[model samples]
Target: MNTRAGEAEAVDLQVQGRVAWRHAIRSLLAQPRGSIRMYSPDYADWGLGAPDVIAGLDAWAIGRSQTSVRMLGQRFEGLQRDDPRFVQWRIRFAHVIACHALPEECGGLQECLLLPEIGLLVIPSEKSRLAIYCSGARLHAAVHAFDQSWEHSTPMFPAHTLGL
Candidate 1:
């Protein structure tokens, strides 16, 4: 299914077809960090507990160069930020996006865009569909959407800051 097209039928198919999604994820993991820009609504629950990928992101964030991760409409936050492993993230640019506390039907509490070089991964919730893109223009459009929602949200403590 081509998630990029916003087709509900496509998303439903992909969610039920684990084998196909698994292969796509593996391909994503194989890419170099610079070649990928990951945007997800929830980093805490992603990748089925893949330690290597988690560690790699931590290491990458710590370098003098900047690495960006944006969170949109997040419903829950994870505990990694307090861990020393996430120190790099604190110093870098991490944008958390949310709505203005709307009810769940309006797309729930979280929606994220993980921008990797290969494409954008949209993980709004569990078993959600992921979108792939190779163009910056596509990514930029997603970013704009995130920003629009983010602007309406009142400031709240990031889940990490709440000692989650």
Candidate 2:
């Protein structure tokens, strides 16, 4: 479960089922000090909208003034209906959290959560409810890929929508 590559310490955990995935994600969320980046098709099944997770995110965002959370997804059409708590959390932390939609030209993107400063990476599978937690040098490639996708993404899921 733990390995070392060069000077970096690495830990890997393979988890199955929704409960396990949520636990893994919560654990990863607890480790970040500076930033968090996440990518998913729509985040509908990831349990990220759960109350506890939203509370944890709220705590994390307040832990530091410079902390930032970036989320990129293929689409988020149903997020407001499916994850109202998460929507509210986003609204409260609008200055700290940002959501983006991946452009069609970007093609397929694997679901992941990356904490670059902490060197942690989480890759999750929605259909099977499986996830892998990886750390250390392995994070480099995932971080790079995420950065590229983020660069091509457009703002989405705004905290507030203006109504006339």
Candidate 3:
């Protein structure tokens, strides 16, 4: 994507595949006080498939205050049973991490991070991937879209279990 507001103009690089995914996750973790909203088929799959990324996200939760991580996707019942990494995470950081149901029509996001200062969208093809980071004026629009999606989402965990 073009950096219309000169936000990411200095960096014209686009990392692909696993490298790009790692970079995107790391960037999301670096944000001190922002929410992370992602959509996927099975959000819990990340915990099983990417150990390092899951660890980094847990670290982010322990260090950051007043932040939220919302995962919008199909219901992941396995998170409580089969996903040990996320089971541990929910035990300790359940307050900051929430899973939401994505509408059938929306399907899921390729990958997205709508932070306060930046926005990231990950596009993938059969052969490769493209990750885009947006800043400046465009970032505002991304955040707005995330807010709108978040409003219609319902919690994946039961109301009794959500600490916050």
Number of the top-ranking candidate, with TM-score as the measure: 2
Write down the worst ten-residue block by lDDT for model 2.
117-126
What lDDT score goes with residue 147 in model 2?
Answer: 86
Tens-place lDDT per residue, model 3, 1-164, is 45556345423346577665655656565433467766655543244324665666676688655538776666667655666665666557767777777676754445566666666666666787666776665566656666677677776754245365
lDDT of each: 0.40, 0.74, 0.61
**Model 1, residue 67: C-alpha shift (Å):** 7.7
Which residue runs of candidate 1 sit more than 4 Å off their true CA positions? 1-45, 64-67, 77-112, 121-130, 154-164
Candidate 2, 86: how far from true, in Å?
0.9
Score candidate 2 by TM-score against the native: 0.83
TM for candidate 1 is 0.46
- Candidate 3 shows a clash count of 0
Residue-level lDDT tens digits of model 2 in 1-164 = 55445576655667777677677676666545568888877776567776667767877787455528889987887777888878888888888888999987896666787886433334444566766666666777778888889899999989999999
Model 3 stretches with alpha carbons more than 4 Å out: 1-12, 30-32, 44-55, 63-67, 77-83, 107-110, 157-164
- How well does each candidate superpose onto the true structure, as a TM-score? 0.46, 0.83, 0.67
Candidate 2 achieves a global lDDT of: 0.74
